[model samples]
Target: MEAHSVQVREACDRRAWVRDSDRSSCKECTKGFSLTRRRHHCRVCGDIVCHSCSATVYLRNTTSNVGRACQSCARPSPDQSTPPPAVYCVICLDPFAAQSDALVVTLPCQHAFHRHCADPWLATHDECPLCRHQLSQDRTAFLEFISF
Candidate 1:
């Protein structure tokens, strides 16, 4: 049974993938879409399927921690890749706060914040506000990268 399930999952993963925007109907059941019956994509195969035909699967291999997968691709395939940390400015409580400002600064940990907001906080502290990640190094590399 385990081997059979694995085969089914592998077959699903090998099926033709579709982008989220290109999906029209349920790939598995060929069900025509409606207002209530929304479309969902299988994380592994990227097939647009109906909610009833999809299952919530923990995506251990990809950046998304959890996502919907078709019945055939429901099996988990764990990998060693680490997901990228979510970017949000702690001071402004916004994801694109840095982009809104003229001057932006990114920490060594890849967390970004507006230069004006970060400078005051960084002047007395040596840690990130969001994750509390330590900032022992200077901001030369980050400054050079964003130089306009």
Candidate 2:
């Protein structure tokens, strides 16, 4: 089960979030929300779910997790190596779909994000989020790379 969980975490793009107001009940159990029975979003499919219908998944193999996933997405897919439309802009928690017109950039740390999202972030942070490696201070190289 641990190995399956690892695969599920890797194969699933668990960042796409659903707007809270979009759902009125759990997609799995069809349980309506109340003050006590709150709705939870499945990190994988972005489906609104109940606590019993969702299971906590650790994407980073850490003690803490980003959120829980519904039972459907928690199961490892048969062909788990190939994930679909999974590239996402961590800044906005939005997926970078293949057909999208958004410009994407990959930092030295290998983390990829939309160019628009990353440019502003790089200007302020001057470092990669996944890796603490500071980007080169040379503006000429950076400018040439982005202009491409």
Candidate 3:
């Protein structure tokens, strides 16, 4: 048996962006988007944030590439609850480590992947990679917020 280790990179952008209609305020600042304050998605966490809440940070995947990242993701802080980039796109098994502008997507089953990987995969399988939950069975209703 041989031991192997894999490295992963966090994507700076998400292919399946949280629909503009879905978010009314910046996820970080919680400020409403206005003419002066526009909506920008954080490349790191795929969160919609206002300009003040967004930071132009160096992409973790590449040396020369830079992209917009959210305040929380720009630093290794205490917000571990905020999900990091997918370890690897299940379909391609490609680590996102060096991809500065990769497109990421989150399935209804709660699994995330690179969009390029998920699109073709879902077209053929029509089911989640890890859960095997059929996409056709997913509900149309979008829950605004979860209550614990």
lDDT leader: 2
User: Which runs in model 3 stand beyond 4 Å of their true positions?
Assistant: 1-9, 62-64, 77-148
lDDT of 2 by residue, 61-106 (tens): 3223234678887665777554333357777778776654666666
Clashing pairs in 1: none
* Candidate 1 local lDDT, 21-132, one digit each (tens): 6877788898888898998767667777998897654333433233567876774346523345445556886664323344555553456666666777776665676688
True lDDT of residue 38, candidate 2 = 93
Clashes found in each candidate (C-alpha, N, C closer than 3 A): 0, 0, 3
Q: What would the TM-scores of all predictions be?
A: 0.37, 0.42, 0.42
Computed on alpha carbons, the lDDT of every model, listed in order, comes to 0.56, 0.60, 0.57
Looking at model 3, report the run of 10 residues with the lowest lDDT sum: 139-148
RMSD of candidate 3 to the truth, in angstroms, is: 13.9
